[model samples]
Target chain A: MDNKTLEQLKEKANIIRKDIINMLAEAKSGHPGGSLSAVEILTYLYFKEMNVDPTNPQWPDRDRFVLSKGHGAPVLYAVLAEKGYFSKEELMKLRKTGAMLQGHPDMKGTPGVEMSTGSLGQGLSASNGMALAGKLDNKNYRVYVLVGDGEMQEGQIWEAAMTAAHYKLDNLTAFVDNNGLQIDGTNEDVKNVEPIEDKWKAFGWHVITIDGHDFQQIENAVKEAKETKGKPTAIIAKTVKGKGVSFMENQVDWHGVAPNEEQKEKALKELEVRI
Target chain B: MANIATREAYGAALAELGEKYQDVVVLDADLSKSTKTSEFKKKFPNRFFNIGISEQDLMGTAAGLATCGKIPFASTFAMFATGRAFEQIRNSIAYPNLNVKIAASHAGITLGEDGASHQAIEDIALMRAVPNMTIVNPADALSTKKAVEAAILHKGPMYIRLGRLGVPEVYKEDMDFRIGKGILLEEGKDVTIIACGFMVHIALEASSMLKEEGISAEVIDMHTIKPLDEEIIINSARKTHAVVTAEEHNIIGGLGGAVAEVLCENYPVPMVRVGIKDVFGQSGKPLELVELYGISAKDVAAAAKKAIAKK
Candidate 1:
């Protein structure tokens, strides 16, 4: 992509980060760390990547995305709102009882959501279906699914990985937000997903490791994924949980904890400024 | 009418769905022939996905397709879909409320010769326990078509339980069927006969025999067992003062339990649950096994009278 387009996408991502902070702060609950960490990737997909129609959200043959780790919905919600899938004001409704913006993604209630994901490792399989369908129908659309490092502990993801590889689902690309933190604590403290990239490669995916926060690197990885054929691709993105904000960054406590007013202000400010 | 099994109806409806809705796709777990989706695979080869024998992967794949604006009908035996891949259905499909219609054929004792291993007697209970899942058991080929159509339009994770063997078509082709509503087949004042799937036809036959014996009976095809047409069943039970539930499932956790739980909680009516008496099924012909388990018309009529005696 051109430098101008890249800068604009980054700007859009900052706006999404702002929404994530505001929404989480409003709900007084949610996964802020992972939400913040995934903003860059989410923004890149919604703004600079995926072929989605905000107006016709259910348009068939459109490029699909699955947010496998659904707790980080603040990021996805922000992206969807900005993209006009729903009103931007719906951000305040996040996690409210009976609200369309549920704790996790509800495919029926929300627009532009591919699956109702909150349970981890399952989204990969769903994306595998989309990729397989695209191949079967000979549709040119690509499928992207974002997963959490911690979410990888679930056995279904590997099951999907194996199936996707076996079916040669080249139309699918999965991104692992190596945020290092989960609900209880750090991923390493709980379960070791250390050999994650190798594990995916062994499953027959074309593996690419990149600095997830870097827009250019993410763009390049996505482009390279499209060029590769025969098997699915896995982009192992090393990202900071609760990125952009100083206090929230790398802190496992911030995994699902919402930022208070003061913290939100600081986070919003941090995202507004460059880097 | 032509020995059309409900499983074949599921496949036929899916094949038809593929023709109309380009976004509709079918996923199978290597039992396409058993599930009767092989016909669909033949008609719409591109939309039919064979995910090998992995039931978990099959469910997860269907959920994924639903997210991408595709309506996915996942075909598998009820034993596998609801038993093996239940977590996948709960987590991926029901949890997300994705529009993944699980068309599980070979439900209940009608799976016959396959024994207890292949019989999905507890699927309704397991699938109903999961939040945001719409459970259905269509009695005949026509109702199966309607259930499949309704499930496709329902806009949530759904389970449509169908049988393997051919049963009498109990509904008219023009009969209306909503996803969660029950249809009252016959009206009586002595006992309310509530049944679903294969038992619905049995209930109607039982009610007719009871009528000839001067024992007035109310027959309701309790098709959609989840958001159960409780109002109709409860009203009938209150009016008739007794209820009898029959299914090709176990008495422990199937339509019998689902109905008993609802009735005992709200309306405490004398109810007899006619099905497998908490025992695993043995290999036999579909009809023979159903009759052997007392999930047949004669058994249903006897159970209806037993229930009435309590009242």
Candidate 2:
């Protein structure tokens, strides 16, 4: 976590953000708000945290990541592409017919997608399954999953929450992208998901709250999660709905609507200046 | 022949299979005792996961285990497995074509006094609609055991429907069992009785009754409902010229609907269906419920006669 390394990581995040904008713009439809909000988390995992080999995507002992909030697939696709899991050119063909990158994260079609998740609130359970297998097989590989703040409304999430803790899945870490806004409106306007940290704690998890955009906090939380034992960890990441793009930031309307060419230009220019 | 519940056979088969396949894992949604997954649990407690009463998590966890090369058999009542968590089975398991076996017990009205809420009379239709899902409704204990073994060997999602009632054995231990092929139990020329699950036994009884009436009846045990034994059904229809379908499920979509579809497309024949007449069941004994639901041997015989008269 040196200053130089932090700066490099920030630059990579910006590049990923730009890629998200371009991908969504090209596809003409996708959830850009949540994808942009999760850029730094995805960047840290793929670049600095996860022990995944691009060439051997299906390596038995490799760390696995499930995008539970699958609407934010652009962020994962960008990060995977940057990690050389696939060519950067494939990012542009996302959500298009005959493209390897589907509208949702399809594990069969896309490389580095550990599980196919689109319907919300199922990823943590799937991650727990992998972690349980890892423990059974005596493998040291960890499991990570990213869930949306709005996606917490699903009852299955709580069902899986109890399961992860009940199994004492210490190897599993879940990130709740608390960007506030959902498709219809803000979380407060929709169904409120406040007391998220206490909820995870009550469900028998080690809870860590952090400013999601901060790389130092992100790194520290991951390190602490690895150090903890006997239970899973939930990293409640407080992030903006759209982080890099000023126009889309905290905007509920941008939750699923793709950015037009003019909006895309503005978003990319803002991201470039950050780098 | 011994009378054993299909769920009991599933449990015994899972215990036996656990010794052979080290990668096998069993998951249950707190119905281990009822669903008979407790058999696997007792044999391999470390490999068995009781996922509480949450069927959604049960299915999702099984999907996750499948991705890691573990053969996960997720068990619950057919009502909950196919109804409560249908989306989980569809998106997480079947959409990816994972190697997960949804061995649901207590299918149809035969689940008895738990009544209509617990009975999954339409599970076959629900499972059959999902792509890449192999539906196997075994007729007896031996076939249930074979179906569990076949599911382990098969490399995709499978729904093995098991019953709660103790059914008479329809096959011996050495009976040849295949995934998508039908087992022709009897042959005749008047009418063909295609049945699945507990209804196969009733169909056999109906065939005997038909013989007493001087009508030759053919019976086929269609264990695998999806990727259905179309060849057997078409050939049997051509020979018999009339067909009767028997199932404990609704006549709308179960073995009857599947057979009717195949016959209509391939070889059109006069068909009559013997099942629940598009209605729910009430609390009663298993045999009493079967009789009241109009899925007994007498009903199959009457339906067979109606089909023959139409021909």
Candidate 3:
């Protein structure tokens, strides 16, 4: 990523956080906590990295992205709309009936979405396929997959992890949105995924721990992933749930329930000043 | 007229796909010989993966490879692919709508000596249950080739069902194949015979037999079961007044069930389903198993006769 482009992306990522919260607030039915946690990761991928042409969404050689933690779709929609994959106007239509932006990312409707992922553990495996395909086709494009910390508890994720590491998909990068909160509550309260990075490393991934909200850290980790050879990279991003908002930070209620009108105004105001 | 096995067509098709698309990879769970993906492995050793006899692992691994940008085609018996790796196919492939092709061979009673354990009588229903899975049961060797090619080009999780024994080549190499579409063979006004996979032959033969018996029968190869060719099936039902659906599968939750579900919802036509009667098969000859399960041409003709009488 160019320094100017990186700086621009850093600024855009801050705006995305505000957009995510506001969109959730508008929908009055979204997962702001998770969405806020994954903003920087999506911004770095769409704005700085990934070989994607917004015009040619199905470019076979383009790098692929799968938002495995589907509830956090605001971050992805924000990034895709901003990157010109779709009209930014469609961002407000999220979760509304007849909207291209469904509650979950539907590949048939959404441009630049490699696969339809809403279920917890399936996204990593799909990304693993894309990475393996890149190797088979001798393509330089990488596969990026984002997973929720709570979602890692699903057994299918581990199965995919084992397969990715076993196959030596060096072109694959998986980022865990480790915000410590799930719909039920905290990750420890729901399902303890302690030693998360160690677990990924044991599964043969090149593991990296980073602050998810930090643009520089996220960018550096992705850069390291591109450098890693013969092993899939896993970024265990330690993040605060609803990091940008003061009222919703580390709060479980905001996981799925979108902010009402009053809450939306406060969130947007707080996010605008902080970033 | 019949010569080589349909599984051999799969082998040839895989080799062709590997040649055309470098990204086409094959994953075999120690069933390369049975599933006949050995040809694909020979051409693309770098793209071939032998993941032991773990069906669950095969599905997940295939999903992973697809995620990485490879169009992974995992080969195994239909029973193992659908039965054993069901959850993986559902969660990893179908749920996410990944482009993983499952080349499931030895489906239905044609699997023969392997008995009920290996026969995949419920694969169609099992796969069709998934929201976005494309359930394809190609009729003949040529149709298998076309179906395989079509499944690859189409973007999504697809299950391509193939037979074990040698079947007739019903279509020419130039025949165009489309996913979610049915191929209409013999059109008649007496009774429509909607079939898939091995039963497509039976339906064709039944059409001929029904013609001889002064009962005109419409025959359709409903290859894509999940996307039930409603346009053709409904039209056939409306014109013929009744329908006979055939397949070498269980009476419940198979092609018969799929067709019945379609008819019940839309047309409500009188139908006779000719397939396995919700029972398992015993060790026997391929033909013997097909006949014993009542999925042969004669049974289909009898079903056509019955469906016509219902009118």
Candidate 4:
């Protein structure tokens, strides 16, 4: 809320970005572009917005979060490790056979993951289910999900959007990481997901657009989402593909390719100097 | 013994189960009336969710409910539940080993009139491929009721296939039902006739037909297809030395394929598979379609004889 808190979150985001590079560099294969793009969103949720206990990860009353764009698991794993959900040691062993952190977000293997998600567009529906259960049980805990901009091409997202609005799931807030680039190319080149904000509105969701890297805007949108009633909110977060890194920034080639040793060094150095 | 659709028994059993387990929730993809989850909806309106026609959302939402310590039974036509939402069930429910029961009705050619598009001849094979998924194809009304109760008692993902056509009751009310165990209805030394779903009744009829021929065919109702009753299958195959499997599904990967795999690996018996022969169904009366699809009792009887001859 204040300059000190915002500055602290920014520092935390820088550290998480470095961790993403390091984890991907070690694993030799992962989505670094999307993970870096979603650093601020994950940092803000774990550090400031959400009410979760790392010690009691399965606390029933705790707020739940789903990483809808599950290929961006590096960011989630980094954030969860930072929050002490598991050891920071597990971050390196990601995607390894018999490791706790899977290639995708596995709720059973990972302590902080709310739902197992890798296949796109299914997380919002799972979020709606959790929100519906919360309403049924009369629990005040909210549900949050982060979906990729490219992930919007999935029809299940709209189906879930209709469900959330039809059920009046005010407790559910979704963030669309509009990084504008996918694995193939730019979203425009691959499949235009433009009129994105209007699409969520047409689905009866309260839409809010924000600069994803800005902590203050991310905070305000989450706050407004909580106060809104009778409908769920969709925060369309405009972000750069690979926000903090130099060579990877807005590069389509970085989508699923892990950085080599030299590239990882460059990326980490850039993150260190950015703040 | 009353004739009732397995879906109807499912509806009644779900309503009863809802009263006993307050955490039991039902979700349907706009086919609640057909799926018989409407009965559960009528009993627990607040707990039931009609997820519109979105089968993908239906499965994902059910998986979400399961994470919250609720036993969510997601229902739809078997075609949609396993066919359309295969990935959702795999990644969301089965992958997590979630406590979501997929009670899919209108399975097989017996769904009738809706034709090939609606018939789920490959559902068993699809579900069988997924790890941590337990496939239960119950025969008749009483077994369907017991299957519902067992699904609630069992944790993790389960696919309970039900039928639209009313079938003659093969078991009494107090029949012993277990998730992975098969029931031996009649014992014979010549050949074993293994069947699931509505085919169990046909298998019994085939056994009687074999009796007239002095073949002495054994009848076994293999309700649970996955985590299959391998012991019963191996033991029976060893004694009979011949096996015939009948199912209202594709012979490639249904009860027939499962039985074949067991016998070939463990007991190595002469086996004949009586099923759809890898063809889709056409719109017709249920019994007419059953006969036309080559899954009739006479078909099973002939298959049993063929297996016996091979032995």
Candidate 5:
């Protein structure tokens, strides 16, 4: 990618970070650390990688995405709005009664959401279904899924991993957002999920490790995933929990709690400087 | 009456459905042979998926397939499909209201010789608790085939329970089958014998016995348990004023419980439930298990007599 494109993506990522901070603060309940960490990945997929149309979200041949780590719904909502899936006004009403954006991603109500997901370790299986459908229909559209590193503790994730490889779903790509934090504490202290790349490789996945926040690495990993055939790809991304804001970065306390009005103002000012 | 296992009918129905619907995909968790999905696999090898012994993965993959416009029929033993993978079914399939059909085999104590661990006496109750789920328990092989056809045509989450034991065919192959429609097999004003699954045949036998004893007993095949035929149940309850509910499952939270819930609110008739009396089934022959669990024809007749006496 060129420097100009990289700069544009960076600016978009920072705007998404601001939206996440504001939405969580307004909703008065939601996860921030995980949402912040997943901003760039969601931006890259909705903006550059995926062949999605905001107007015709249900087009059969369009590429699909599943937020497997569904608690990070704010980031997905922000990026979708940025891509014109819905209005930016809907972001503030998230988690409110009768709001289109619920605490979780509801595919029925939300546009550009291929599958409704909040439960962890379940999205990969759905992604495999989409990829298989593409194969069955002879369409070149690919399927992408984003999973949390803490979600690896679920046994179902491994089961889905096995299914993806057993079927030889070369069109499917998975990313483990290795921010290393769970609701309780750090992933290592709560439940060790290390050796992540080796695990996917053993499960017969073509593996790639990259800096999740880096646009060039993100682009390269996706390109590699597309080029590789006959096996699914697992891009293990190393990211910092709460990537943009100074106070929340790498802080376990921000995993699932809304910021106060004063704290939100501070966070927005910090993100604005980057833009 | 022809005798055949409902699981066998389910296998045959899936193969026939594959011929008509090109996008129909079948999945199983190492129980394809027993569940009868192996038949579909044989015909549609390219569309069949055997996810080994992982029921959770089977459900998740089925949900994924449904999202991609494939009508996936995920099959396994009732215990594994409903019990082992309960959360996966609840979150992945039911929550999304996906077009996935879970055709579970070996439901209830009729799956004899497998003992309590394998028998799924609570599968119906477990499935009923989830929203956006349709539950069907066919009385015979013909009804099982019809149930499969109905499930395939209906584009939503469904659970069709089939039994391993051979049951007497209660309906003809050409009988019209619809979801949530109960079949009125026999009619009487003295009492009503409402049954489902293997116990439907027993209920018919009980009705005949009641006739010999100078009592007019009504018999109904309540095939679809959820989205139940409440009109039929309430109308029969009003006429008979007494009821005996029979099923091959536990009395609590199965056919009996469902009937009682409907009648208590609508008609409030005297009722006796003929099923496994809150006990796990031990390994035995199919008929022996049915009798030991107190779900035989004699039990249905006796329960009807008791209900009549109460009235």
Candidate 6:
């Protein structure tokens, strides 16, 4: 939580952002909007918050993370590589056939991913399962899941929310990347997932809101989640559609489109100066 | 040992499995009493999870539990387990090839009075279409018990369908039940009647009727639908030169379709299917529905006779 540590995490976040752009530009297709939006959150967790051992991804006592909003695999793939779960060469093979990094988070193919999630709105339920299992085995490992704001349109998320709170799975924490924009348009135009915080609160989750781009608030929210008991926590992270790059920021067109050569060069240049 | 419903056998087996396997966990979507998962819930209260009327959450949560090394038995009425939560079961549990056992109760038309809405007539077909899914529809209570035990020992996703009606005991308690291996109940030469679930019991009765008519009929308990017992089916089809498939499901995609796919490719035979002729069930007594839906013993006998006549 020190300034020095925070600065290091910020530099890591910029690297992750650059990786996201580079992978998408090479793959010729991937979700860039949500991936960029979640850079800081993934960077913070992999670097500081989560008790994950990249060297031993299957360590039983280690905390588990499910990328529920799995379209953002580039971010997770980049962070896992940066954290040494796999080599940096695997990042270049993103979405390629016979690659460890799939189009979505595949737990079997990838080392660090805890659950195979691509279809949205199902990750939180799986996270609940991990937390519930941890409690049953009397283990102290916590569970974390990252969901998208548009993913909330699916009813299963609410059902899982009720389940997590009902079981008093205080060991679980979920982050909704409230990037405000989805594939079709703004969340308000697509399905209107506003009053998002109140929705989680009504579902009995200990709700927390934070600027997702800020690493300090991300770490503090995770700490607060661990301190709370007898209930799950939902940290509604407010984020821009594309956080770092100039042309892609707050743009719905970048939700799934890959960048061209010129655009990728420009984005990498901007991130380089930030690093 | 006793005549009981398949659902009842599943509940008792679950409670017994709880004592043997500490990592075994049970989950239901608010129909514990009806599905009989309540028995396991009673014995292992701490390990039981009732997600309360949400089948999607029930399946996804079960997948999570499986990931953590907990062998989760997610149970519900077949209609919801395979019908309502189809995609969740496919994407969350089956796609990952997770070690989750889905023991769905009240399968087929014998669920009675609740009619077609509750009856999971096509549950097997739905489950069979998914990759990495093993489908087991037990003949009677005893087989249901053995199937549940085998499902737990197997290290992947399995769909064990149980019926609501109490059926006559077919296999003895000491009978060895192996997955993907058909149980030949009776042997004959005229025609073979391959059946599953409640229809297996009727196939036995139909074989008796065929015996009286001087037409020898072979009876097969085709329990495992997916990873089907092709050896037994082809062997029987080749021997009898005629076949009849019976089930408490639509004739289109259930056991009949599976048998036809196997026979048409391997050993072609004149086959007649006795089932719910691609129509929905109406509110009636379980027996009345069986007779009305054309899946009763007499119907199987008729289908067998028709198939033999063709030969």
For each of the candidates, the C-alpha root-mean-square deviation to the true structure, in angstroms, is: 3.7, 0.8, 4.3, 1.0, 1.1, 1.1
Residue pairs clashing in model 5 are none
Q: Which candidate leads in DockQ?
A: 4
lDDT of 5 by residue, B1-311 (tens): 66899999999988988999898999999999999999999999989999988899899889988988899999999999999999889999999899999999998887889888999988988998899999999988888888888888898999999999888879865787889999999999999999988888899999889899999999999999998999999999889999999988778888889999999898899999988888888788888887787888888899999999999
Q: Give the TM-score, chain B only, in order for the candidates.
A: 0.97, 0.99, 0.98, 0.99, 0.98, 0.98
TM-score of 3: 0.82
lDDT of each: 0.87, 0.93, 0.84, 0.94, 0.91, 0.92
Could you tell me how far off, in angstroms, the CA of residue A187 lies in candidate 2 after the best superposition?
A: 0.7
Better of 1 and 6 by lDDT: 6
Model 6: CA > 4 A from native: none
Model 3 - which docking category? Answer: acceptable
Question: Between the candidate structures 1 and 6, which one is better when assessed by DockQ?
Answer: 6
Off by over 4 Å in 3: A1-10, A51-62, B1-4, B20-24, B49-74, B80-101, B112-118, B126-135, B149-158, B166-194, B200-243, B257-270, B279-292, B296-298, B301-305, B308-311
Provide the DockQ value for model 1.
0.50
- Per-residue CA lDDT of candidate 1, range A15-52, in tens? 88888899999999998889989888999998888999
Which residue pairs in candidate 4 have backbone atoms (N, alpha carbon, C) closer than 3 angstroms, thus clashing? Answer: none
Question: What DockQ score does model 6 reach against the true complex?
Answer: 0.88
Task: Give native contacts recovered, as a fraction, per prediction.
Answer: 0.83, 0.75, 0.48, 0.86, 0.66, 0.78
Q: Report the C-alpha lDDT of model 2 over B46-114, residue by residue, as the tens digit.
A: 999999989999999999999999999999999999999999999999998899999999999999998
Give TM per candidate. Answer: 0.85, 0.99, 0.82, 0.99, 0.99, 0.99
lDDT of 3 by residue, B1-311 (tens): 75556778999999987888876889998889888899998887888988666677688668767755668899999999999889878876787677899989999888899788888888888987899888888888888888888988889899999888888767755776898889888879999988888888778888898889898888888888878788888888899989998888888998888888889999998899998898888889999877777888899998888877787
Q: Which 10 consecutive positions of candidate 2 chain A have the poorest summed lDDT? A: A266-275
Model 4 ranges off by over 4 Å: none
